[model samples]
Target: MSKRMLALACALALLLTACNESARPQPSEGAAEIWFAVGTGEDGGPLVDGGGAVAPEYRALPDEADPVEERMAALLSGPQSAELRSPFPSGVRLRSWRLEEGVLRLDLSEAYGGLSGVDLTIADYCIVLTLCQVEGVEAVDITVEGETVPYRGRKLMREGDVVLSGGEGEPVAITASLYFLRRSGGLASESREVLVTENDTLATAVMGALMAGPRDQEELYLPLPEGTELLSAAVEAGVCYVNFSRAFTEGAPQSREEAARLLYAVVDTLCSLDQVEAVHLLVEGESLDRYGGVPTRNPLEKDYEMAGEEKPAAASGS
Candidate 1:
């Protein structure tokens, strides 16, 4: 993996490793049901209610075989509710599956590439959440017709691009306060309860959940682009340094005001963390003072609030 990708993965894994201060609820030991992040309603986006394990006890399979493949079979069955949906459509089939090191490698039919935009987003999460439940699997690598499909950018999702999903055996739940832009102004804080792995750091999971947006509410907006990667991150003292792929700062926001909102949506979300009193935003690993004229320097104090506020015409600073 490239240093950038490795750094990002380390950021996420380290988050889970470090955040063990308080007691975290363990995942269900008897995982009776598995959850898949499937698309719901016409405009409901992705909701985790898809498949609930094909067999009552997947861990007790009689034969010594690939357990991940068995879970994939259940996922292929699709969501029980008509309101929910899966990415594995009519022509899409799991051509093959294997587990290497900690990554679950998935090869699907060409039809898998048929999904795009929001549909693709829902589908990707569905597969990731479903398969990552198996033991020894830490991440998933997906391919279509033997080729790596370009997901959010030219860099195929080989590492950090992987979506962190809830495992089947059990789920760790935590509440986080994520910030979003409100039409009325002022950075609005929304408290969200999210499920993550035992190894997942609250900070990384919160960022992941933030990127997923405030669920069940349409008013709040996701600050980053669809394919943006949380390149790398670390929390020190009171400052949280989060790095994103180029996709974040490229193709600038429509205007300066919009840019400020985007920047704070990120700042406010991270600042919500008890350990984080400031936020430092970076693209790749470089600290950008400004992107397309939007001030993104960090150690961005809580007082530099986005709520009921707007950036000055000459907005620029950390």
Candidate 2:
């Protein structure tokens, strides 16, 4: 071959080699993993010495020298004051935390109680929002003790009791207060003498009230859209059948997931009652399974044993 032809052939061979190399599977930059020493917040900042297991790859995030627990505590304690108080008290104790891929795993202590439907919703939003605010975190998995709270009706990790269903009834007459977050700073509290009753079936009572109450008014239970009406509710076997007028279906603006969430809300409310084992979504006196594709098992259904299953009379943190 001529010198020019030889050079051309060499260039083609190099290009082919490059293509072959590109085609070969390259190992992942591997999932970024980091270890954050858990720390408690003192007057200054997180008191970190340097001793903690490395966070799993799925729960790992961008490297930070600060203790993860202390940072999380500060974040929870900061501007989102109202968000944390919905379950009642203003204390959230972190048991553990890990980060891998884009998900943050947060293990909370049982001290974070008094959580209700609204309160749990607040907690969900708070954790997701807070973690996603961090540069690398895209999602969060929250667990109490060693059990994980199932989100969107599926157990991503190990099983744990979702407080969404099954609570105990302890009638306590305490001065009820509502707190709203101010744009400026701190929470604005309004005191009212409302009877606070805790019952495994209390959520059911709230759902019943929502189903029976006026559609035009706003209450603690049913937060309806522009034009929705509750038709009826009945308990059959273990299922609580909740029926709503066509207006309830037509007037409410909800996506598939949102509708599922709404259904879970209702189910969570009702299933908290000992008498009701599950909930059936209905519209215009028919099961939503035929029309709306509502799942037979709603979001609140979980496999984990409840917090007080073994010890029936265990008092929840107030």
RMSD list, candidates in order: 17.0, 24.4
Task: Give the per-residue lDDT of model 1 (tens digit) for 15-118.
Answer: 11211213222345554233333322222122222221111112233245566766666677765655344455465778987778988888998777754322
* Strongest candidate by lDDT: 1
lDDT, candidates in the order shown = 0.54, 0.39
Q: For model 2, how does the per-residue alpha-carbon lDDT over 1-318 read when each residue is reduced to its tens digit?
A: 443322221220100011122322233452222212122222111122211100111222335534455456544443322211222135557877788896678878764443433334334444543355455665677776777543223323221221211223322221212222222322222222222332112223344333332322322223345445545555555566666677766755355544443444455445543234666767777755432246553423421131121222445678
Candidate 1 whole-model C-alpha lDDT, 0 to 1: 0.54
Estimated TM-score for each candidate = 0.44, 0.31
How far off is model 2, as Cα RMSD? Answer: 24.4
